[model samples]
Target chain A: MKVSSVVWLTLVWVLLWGTFTPLTLVGGVVVAVLVLWVARQAPSTDRLPVRPLRLLALVGYLVYDLLVSGAEVSWQVLRHGPRACGAIISVPLLTSSERVVTLMASALSLAPGAMALEIDHDAGVWYVYALGPRGASDVERTWLRTMDVQRRVLATFGTPEELARVRRLIEERVA
Target chain B: MITDVVSAVLMLAGALSCLLGALGLVRLPSLLSRLQAATKPQTLGLFLVLAGTALRVDLKSAATLLLVGLFQVITAPVISQIVGRSVHRSGGVRPEVLVVDELAEERPQDRPS
Candidate 1:
C-alpha cells in the first residue's frame, strides 16, 4: 500500500464528506481502505519520485510563469488579434514515467498559450496544440515557452538518474 | 490592517488575471487557442480569488475554500481534455492553420472527411 495513495484517498474521502469530524474521520478510514484495495487490484503503473524541494521550486516557477505569460499573452492577443497562425507541434519527452509525462502535460496545458492534445506514451511524445507558428512569430514563442514548462516539470519530479538522462537528451537535441 | 491590505491585493490580482483570460478568449485566433487562453488565468485567478476569500472568512470556511481549490485543480484539465478532443475531431479548427496534423495520421479514416 502506497502511503501517499492512502493519504490522498483519505483526503478525498474527507472532502466528499465535507467535514473533518471524528465520525467523518472514522468514515474516511473505511473509505480510504476500500479505495486502496481497489487501487491495488488495478494494474499499477509507474509513479515519479517527486522531490520536496524541487516541487517547491516548481510551484515558485509556475507562479512566475503564470504572471509573466499572462501579461505576454494578453499583450499578444490584444495587439495582433486572432489569426490562423497556430501550429500542432510534437515535443519529445525524455521521461518514461507516465506520472511525469502526465504531470508535464497538465502543467504545459496550465500555462498560457499551450494546450496539450495527446500523449503518445509508447513514443514518449506529446502533441501540443499551441498558440503560434514555427518561428515566424507568436506560435514559435509559445512553443518554446510550452517546452520550458515541460523542462521545469521534469526537473521537479525526475529522479537523479532520470534528470541526468534528460540533460543529455536536451544537450544532444541542442547539438 | 496589513493582512486586510494583503487580501485585497490578492483579490485585485485575481480579478486582473481573470480579465486577462477573458481578453485572451476574445482576441486569440482559434477555438483551441481561445480555450488555452481561458485556462491558466482562470484556474490561477479563481484559486487566488478563493485564497482571498479564505483570508476574509473564518477557519472552517477557509478549509472549505482549500478543498475547493484542490477539486478545481484536479478537474479543470479533464474538462479541457474533453473540450480539446471534441473540437479537434469535429473540425472546429481551421485546417490550414494546423502546421502538423498527426491525429489525422493516427486516424487515417478521419483525413478525407
Candidate 2:
C-alpha cells in the first residue's frame, strides 16, 4: 500500500487500539507517526494540506454543535413525542477525496440526532438523516447550511475549484 | 464535597437523558426520527456519564472515558448519516417535502426494480 494509505490506516489503528491494550497502543502510536512522516515525504495526489487554525476552528464548531444538538434532542424527547420527528435527507458532497468525504460524513454523523447512512463516492453524495423540524424547507435550509460548513472544512485541504463544485452542486440541489 | 454533589447530579441527569433518548428511539415513528432520538441525547448522556465518572475515577480511567466519549462524538453522526441515506435511497418518501429532487430526475433508469 501507499505511504499515505498506510499512514491513515495506522492512525485509525492507533485510535482503535489505544483504548484497550497499552502495549499495542504505544506501538500503534509509533507506527502512526512514522507512517505520517513517510507519507509527508512521498509525492502523491491524496496529499492533505490542512490549515491548522481552520481545522481547530472546525473542531470547536463541531463540539459546540454536538453539545447543543444533544440538548435539543433530549428536550424534544422530554417535551413532545419522538414521533414528531421527520424524514431522512440526502446531502450531496462535493469533494472527491476519500479523506475529506470520510471526515465530513463521520463528523456530521457524530453530531447528536444525525447519522451518515450512505456515501456514493462516484457521485460525491452523502445521505444523512436528521431530526426534522416544523417545515420541510426549514429542514432543508438547516441541512444545507450545515453542509456549507462541511464544504468549508473540505476546502481547507482541497482546491477552490473542488469547493466551488461542491457549493454549486449543493445550490443546484437545494435551490 | 460540592464537586461530588455536582458530579452526582450530572450523572443522574445524563442517565435520565440517555434513558429518555432510548425510549424515544423506540417510540419515534420513522427510521429518521428514531435515529434522531437515538443519537442526539445519547451523545450528551454519554458525555455526562463519562464526565461524572471521570470526576470520581482515577487518571487512567478518566483518560479511557474521555477517549470513549470522543469516539462516540465522532462516530455517531457518521453512522446516522449512513442509515439516513439508506432510508432515503430505499424509497422512503418525505411526507412534507414539496421540492422536486433534481438528482432523482437526472437518473431515470437507475430506479430500483
Candidate 3:
C-alpha cells in the first residue's frame, strides 16, 4: 500500500472515532498499517494518476448530474404513477481499467435515474438501468450520456496513454 | 440570522427529498425503479441534511458530519448496484415496462427458451 493510502486510511479512522487526540492519531496510524498489511490489494494496484483539475471538473459534473437527476426522478415518481417507462442500455467504454470502470459505475448510480447493473470488463461494456426514458431515441440519448460519463471518468482518473487511446477509439467509432 | 435561515431551508429540502423517496417506494412500478427512488434522492437528502447540520455545529462535529456524507456517497451506489444486479439476475426486472433491455440477452436464464 502507498504511504498516501495509509495516511488517508488513518485520517478516516480518526474521523470515525470522532476524536483527534495524539493517542487516537497514533492508534489510527497503527491500525491503518495493520489493515493494509492484512488486506488483499485491490485488483488494479497501480497508483492512480489523478489530475486535480480534471477530477474537480468530474466531481462538479457528477454533483450537478446528481441534483438534476434526483429532481427529475422525484418529479417522475410524483407525476408518472404506475406507467413509468424505463430502459436498460449498454454503453461501450474505451478503457477497461477495473478501477476507472468501478468509479464510473458508482458515479452513474449516484446520478439517480441511471444505475449501473453490470460491468463486463472484458468487453468494456456497462449495462445500465435507466429510469424514465421513453422511446428508442430516449434510450439512445441515455446510451450517449453514459458514454460521456465514461469519458469524463477516464479523463479524470486514467493515465495520459489511456486518455489518448480513448480519443483514438472515439475517432475510430470503436467506443 | 441569514445562516440560520439557510440551514433551515436546507433541512426542509432534505426532508422533502426523503419524503419523495418514501413515496416512490409505494408508487414506483418495479423493484429496479423503486431501488432508484430509494437510493438516489435519499442520498441527496442525507447530504443536504448533513450540510445543514454542519453549518449549525462546531468544527469537530462538522468534520464528523463530513465523514458521514463521504461514507454515504461511497456506499449508497454500491448497495444499489448489488441489489440491482441481484434483481436482474433473479428475473425481478419486468421486461414489458422496459423500452430497451440490452442486458436481457447477456444472461442465459433471461434468454427466451
DockQ of each: 0.53, 0.42, 0.85
Better of 1 and 2 by TM-score: 1
Off by over 4 Å in 1: A1-3, A15-19, A34-47, A132-134, A137-143, A159-161, A173-175, B97-112
Candidates ranked by lDDT, best first?
3, 1, 2
Expressed as tens digits, the lDDT of each residue in A1-175 for candidate 3 is: 7788789999998998888999889999999999998995864555578589998999899899879877988988999957787998877766656677779888888774988998887887779999989898788778767777777888888777777776665556533
Interface RMSD of each: 2.7, 4.4, 0.9
Best by TM-score: 3
* Candidate 1 per-residue lDDT over residues B1-113, each given as its tens digit: 87798899899998988897898888777787787668767777887798788889878668778888777766777678778877777767666656666666665555436
Q: Pick the candidate with the highest lDDT.
A: 3
The lDDT of each candidate is 0.72, 0.67, 0.84
Ranking by DockQ: 3, 1, 2
Q: lDDT tens digits, residues B17-113, model 2?
A: 7897898876666666777778877787888888888899867567667678877866776666666656556756444431333334444432344
- Encode model 2's per-residue lDDT on A64-119: one tens digit a residue: 87677777776666665634654345666777777777777666665545556666
> Which ten-residue region of model 2 chain A has the weakest summed lDDT?
A80-89
lDDT score for residue A168 of model 2: 80
The TM-scores, chain A only, for the candidates as listed are: 0.77, 0.68, 0.87
Per-structure clash totals for the candidates:
2, 16, 0
Candidate 1 vs candidate 3: the lDDT winner is 3
Which is the winner by lDDT between candidate 2 and candidate 3?
A: 3
